[model samples]
Target: MSNDEDWYQRYLDMQNEYDYENTTDASYVQSKPVQLCSKESLNNFGATIIPVFYYVNFLLSYLGNGLVLFIIYKYEELKSVTNIFLLNLVLSNILFASSLPFWATYHMSEWIFGLALCKIVSSAYFIGFYSSILFLTLMTFDRYLAVVHAVAAAKSRKRAYAIIASMVVWCISIIASIKELVLKNVSENQFSGLMCDESGYPDSTMARWRLVTYYQQFLLFFLLPLFMVMYCYISITIRILSTRMKEKCRAIKLIFVIIFTFFACWTPYNIVILLRAIQISNPGEGVSMCSEEESLDYALYMTRNIAYLYCCISPVFYTFVGKKFQSHFRRLMAKNIPCLKRHVSLNSQSTRTTSQKTPHSTYEY
Candidate 1:
């Protein structure tokens, strides 16, 4: 009996030794350091490229939109609802363009403007972005009314109505951007020094805030407005096609251009924003993959730059395309610029002659 007891004790000791060895090996594997993903190359690329593009955009947007404002103020009586909407659109573009320089500086260096300026700049930027989209939607609706429901539009599209609509759009834009005003501040980054971004919260809280804002922009600014603009343009196209108006083909072409431009400018940015929102929501799969996150960062930057070009292009599409505006601009320049007087007079005479030949043709809007 004593010999059997001793053998059993030895077997139990061997089992314990095996279990301890397995535990020690498992902990050793778990304790190894994780390799962190570095974004230094991406940051350097952005610092090199973003400032240049932003400065160019700022210059072009201000010049184009400012010229539109000057032409409209000098010539238009502000009675046309379309002109009123165009004024608001140009103003929105200017407001948006005003923030580009600050952002350019931010990209080149740290946010040296402090927390107050950061909030103001961020809020203004978002307000201008939101207002510009809203105004475009309103303008499309105005066109839809003019083409699809001409008689009713003639009755309802008054200067008062346009003023009220402008006010409402501005209010909505401010409200939508209130988040930026509330949340934006200068946060310290170890690699980048100070950054003007959302902070003062836990990582989880910041992620949630970002997710909410991204979806808000995606849904309200991009998706909803896109649907509205598409519907308006489609209705306008169908109405123009069914009619026998002499300018129907020209009108259809303009509608196609507007829709195409809108999609080309905004779709990629919004799609990337939606992806970012999804990645934020699904941390286990999306956040764990550093390669995917870095790719998304690159995508977001490129797409946003594409979207920024619209501020410069909007003036050409909305204002300069109109013959009336061109005439006004020529006359304004001729009056102010001595060298162009002779050319302007000749062009004016030629335009008048062309107008006389086509009495039924209206100014392109």
Candidate 2:
């Protein structure tokens, strides 16, 4: 056999023989190398680093998503048309972020949790991630409708529709992710640590499914939303420049920023995944499959981390952008505040006295 075929054969054999075992469990296999052939290049680095990355991501994502939920819940005024989108975004992020711990543990040890959790939790990860993307896409469309087609949007921006759409998005996400249950089975690698990926090593079907998912996300979540957002922003910019409504202009700018942030963080991951799909389809034609997998895996992880930043930074946008949410927030704050209430009462009393002291002018007739 040629050297290339030999290398590929060795890689294939490595895949079949690799054992991932729980060090604590005596039953765990410890016959093969601790790492996969795919990750051979990173063999110099300790496996412990992976867990550390996961833990840090878990902490940041949990705190950020929690705070976003709090901000929306605490301030009633944030429940405007704009914030409806934000609320969905936060909910999706929170659920998605919760999966980090499970992944972190899975990386460190065997799938001791069992098949049910292995299937369900991993599926939940996809659901959360996909749902977030859908919600962001919805938000972009919502913004476009309000800014570009205001009159039509005013009539159609019903809370009922938003609720219905969110429900649909989630339902679809759950259904799409459910397939993971059937696809993933428990397996022990060379290290004897149980892992939960596709049963067959380097399964092309699994790669195709992953590629399809990425493509769907790109078309539905990124491209469509990007087009609409760009159109809306361009139109909004022209309108703002021609008009004198400073507050409205600022609101449009803020919405643009939010859209830009999503696009910036997620675009790299999407492009990389698509390219990965291409490389997978035409393998051994100069593309290093092992290196591609490692790079794509790292890129996916980093992209997810960057995307979570939006969850943390978005509260600031809500506070600063969208005059309506801010107005509502201020009114809610004013009402809840004792000092502001007292001050307002005193101001009202002074106003009454001044009115009583003043004489009516002939113009009153």
Candidate 3:
């Protein structure tokens, strides 16, 4: 019995030695000088969080912007220049929200939709984004003209001019988004199955294209519009402070909200985009590169989600903040909901009396 136990122990030792040798040989054969960064955790986090927020944003933007559109159509005829701009802005929000479901599904899973939809959806998304910024900038300019250069702008701020301006903005947005339609397609990702993204170009060409796209968005869509909005609002503020406008307080409050919301939501995303462009231009080596990329990925994800929320809040800034819109909305609710009719009527009467007292107020809309 002792001899048999000794033989079994010898066999176990020999087997362990063989296994260790094989593992060492395998490791030597497969060893890499530099380890690749894994983004599995980031992808998982995005798949879990992004879809939910996107769906919520879609719902809120659709509801708010849709209600604004309905109120505008029902109560306020598109006669005034402001009303025309407002209509285009609401349309832009709806257009932007319309693409959210596709993106949400894309984030949740892979891009099951085909190549054609990939192109169309991508183009629509960018066009909507650019158009929204343009419309908001145009609105600010319109307000500035109405408030700062009232007499000078009266002749030019016609409905015809507004329509023409909206058309021109749409053309610019579409032109800006042409690359999405041209370059985006359904491609296979090794880790994530298929995705809808830019493809079909040489590596160098694709890299250049991406850099151009980032700068285009950062400069044309974000920075330019931001500067324009800031200039207009600052001018408006100065004019209001210098004058004795009855609605100066409300104007100031609206301007603050607009600037604050725009800056808070978009600045981070633009900064992340600019950083990504710089990183791509000059990529670092090894573990540090991996870490920097991971950080940027996380930042882009978070800041993009924040930026998307702007559409959801746009209706509040553009329409709900206006007393005229409030009166119209209340009247609209009163028309639909019989229970609130009496209360709304009384409120409308009070609003009308106040408006009559201040008949020449240009800031009502």
Candidate 4:
């Protein structure tokens, strides 16, 4: 029995030694280093936590943006130049939010849909993202003209001209997005898994073009517009404070709140991306260009998640704040107090009759 036990122990020791030798072989040691940002790992992250959060965010943003669009479209009162710009903004955001599901799905797994979807999905993202920024910038400019140069703006804001300008903005957005559609391609990574991304630009020319495009995006979309928004709001704020016209003050306050809300939702993402662009020389990394590009990627990913939260909830803010809500509350009051409606109707009729009777005759003759 003792001899048998010693023989078994020696056999176990021999097996362990052989296993260690095989593991340390040169061939085994030369095996490929595992990629940290591989499809499998990214998918794991995307599938488990990231997708669910973004999906909920996307749903909220879609509903809010869609509601805003419907309000602008359904009500003639909400179809003014101000509301028209907002309609376009909401439309762009809706389109942008719609792409989140595809992205979330992609993050969960490899590009299973195919090549065509990759192009269409990615192009929609670019179109919506670019157009959103452009429209917001246009809105700010429109506000600037309306408030700072009211006479000029009024003269130029003819219905036909406004329609044409809106068309032109759409046209430009389409043109700008064409490159993105063409540049993106689907290819397999080192691990034999497929990925739908901008790939196969081996030359410096394509690399440079991508880099330039990213910088352009940052400058045109974020930096320039952000500066303009800041300037317009600051000037407008000063004007409101200086004049202290209590009647117009509420409207000015609404605009300020809207601008602040925009900044609160987007500034972190923009700043993080800008830092990333500064760090990376490549166009693909985007906001991942910071010194700690990998860490930045993770941070941008997290920040984007946070941005979506803010953006998705922004509509709720819009619904509750400022003149929109105040008017709604007043309507509720009118509903509860039917007598107030009768008085308002009577006053409106009286004013209309007086205007019809007097008009140009009382003013000129």
Question: What is the lDDT of every predicted structure here?
Answer: 0.85, 0.64, 0.88, 0.67
Roughly what TM-score does model 3 have, to 2 decimal places?
0.88
Model 1 compared with the native: what TM-score? 0.86
Off by over 4 Å in 4: 1-43, 77-79, 190-192, 203-206, 247-256, 282-291, 306-365
Clashing pairs in 4: 273-287, 276-287, 276-289, 276-290, 279-289, 280-289
Whole-model lDDT, model 3: 0.88
lDDT per residue as tens, model 3, 53-108: 88988998888888988888788898999889888988887888889999989988
What's the true lDDT of residue 155 in model 2?
Answer: 92
Clashing residue pairs in candidate 3 are none
Q: Please provide the root mean square deviation of candidate 1 (C-alpha atoms, Å).
A: 5.0
Candidate 2 error regions (>4 Å) = 1-38, 41-50, 77-80, 200-202, 247-256, 285-289, 311-365
After superposition, the stretches of candidate 1 with alpha carbons farther than 4 Å from their true spots are: 1-35, 284-288, 337-339, 350-363
5-51: candidate 4 lDDT, tens digit per residue: 99999999999999999898977787644333433544455568788
Question: Candidate 1's C-alpha lDDT?
Answer: 0.85
lDDT of prediction 2:
0.64
- Structural similarity to truth (TM-score) of each candidate: 0.86, 0.70, 0.88, 0.70
